[model samples]
Target: MSKPLGKILSEGKTKKVRETENSDVALLEFKDSITVLDGEKMDVLRGKAVINAHISAYFLEILEKKGVPTHYIEFVEPNMMKVKNLEMLPVEIVCRNIAAGHLVKNYPIKEGTLLNPPVVEFYLKDDARHDPMLNEDHFLILGLASRGEVKKIKEITLKTNRILSDALKAKGLTLVDFKIEVGRGTDGKIYVGDEINGDSMRIWEVGTDKILDKDVYRKGGTMEQVLNTYIQLYQKLLGKMPPIRGTKNE
Candidate 1:
């Protein structure tokens, strides 16, 4: 919202990466659009970009404070953040603390089962291929990541899970499961990249089955309903809310 950014570097279902003046930096612009089922379904909701921009930044900021490496730099008002440029890994690291979705669907595990020590898994980020799950060998053999890189990412991913889970628990939300993308930074270190908003994770009200994340959208909830849950999450997680549009702040 300052001077305009350069051409778009890359784009996806819910965000865009734009070139920045600094070669080592990228301007991440959040989109109002939300998608699921590997983008088989999509919708745009007003104010979604702003909500996700702040929510994801808040989560990554928490991770950075707890000694996790990340690409987060500074958030731009409305719907953008500045972040370190890096070579992104073509895989997603998922950590599940509660059995749900694919965890229960693909296996004999029951939904809502609390996974002890949690379950960490990897999947190739190929939407055309339905993002098939991958093991360390598949990751290595395909030259996606080295064995040591895999081990290192698992450490970071689990640590991220604990950090985020505890943070949400204090706000009376359950951290069900989440997916994250990693990238090698200019410093030659692995840094969590992409975004970590509700769209990339699941949340349920503590002690109840009330859903507070994107599952509502995937399960046929209306746009207004989907955003209401996300707004509730922002209020509880950050203890603050952006001023309502058409207000003084607007």
Candidate 2:
């Protein structure tokens, strides 16, 4: 018989999740690094990892309180989170509220157009193929997820959009769009997985198209500017500033 696997479940572009031997909980370690354009662009912005870790934990906790299932357990350290170990699905779910980014480039819609009844998209979570778009049929054919699972994912994702959109509105920000990952838990239930931070979403200041998310960094903004913007957004959302690490407060 084959031996049981050891620790270190998986690693991504900016984070790694590890499971202790004989434990069902995993520790997610966020790195002080950023990647854009499928990681063709990269840099390390001090304090970013900690800020994102806190922000993601805050959002996940809020969602959980709202009855949304998630893998998030608790924030363990400045750049680490303790979470439920999950068998992650190979798909990325995206919910868009405003026409921006690839929506404008791929469609005839103008930038900033309100997508009434927000758009939900599914993409195969393969970095090598740049996460190609997939439809329901595609998913079924590829065995990525069952029809029931897809339905459940969409339901949870839309509910999440409503909750986050309203929450951000109260903070004078617009939830332009966001991406989330999902996974199956030991209980055989799917839950929202991965980090939900600035990097996963496009946030803009209310009433204006002032970018306040990773888009700023992707568009050639300075590291200081990116960090400051993230701090400002986090403060606005949580009503307090996150502690900085390895960087001076701006």
Q: Give all TM-scores, in the order shown.
A: 0.96, 0.93
| Best-performing candidate as measured by TM-score | 1
Error of 2 at 21 (Å): 5.6
Residue 229 displacement (Å), model 2: 1.4
Q: How accurate is candidate 1 locally (lDDT)?
A: 0.89
Per-residue alpha-carbon lDDT of candidate 1 for residues 1-250, written as tens digits (9 for 90 to 100): 5676779989999999999889999999999898889888988877788889999999999999999999999999878999999899999889999999998989999998999989999999999899999998998789988888889999999999999999998889889999999999877789999999888899999888689889999899998898888887777887776544633444
TM-score, candidate number 2: 0.93
| Candidate 2 lDDT by residue in tens digits, 1-250 | 7443336677888998877554788889898889998889999988888889989998999899999999998897668888898899999999999999999999999999999999999999878899999999998999888889999999999999999998888888899999999999999999999999899999999878689899999889998899898888778877777788543443
**Which residue segments of model 1 deviate by more than 4 Å?**
243-250
Model 1: lowest-lDDT 10 consecutive positions = 241-250
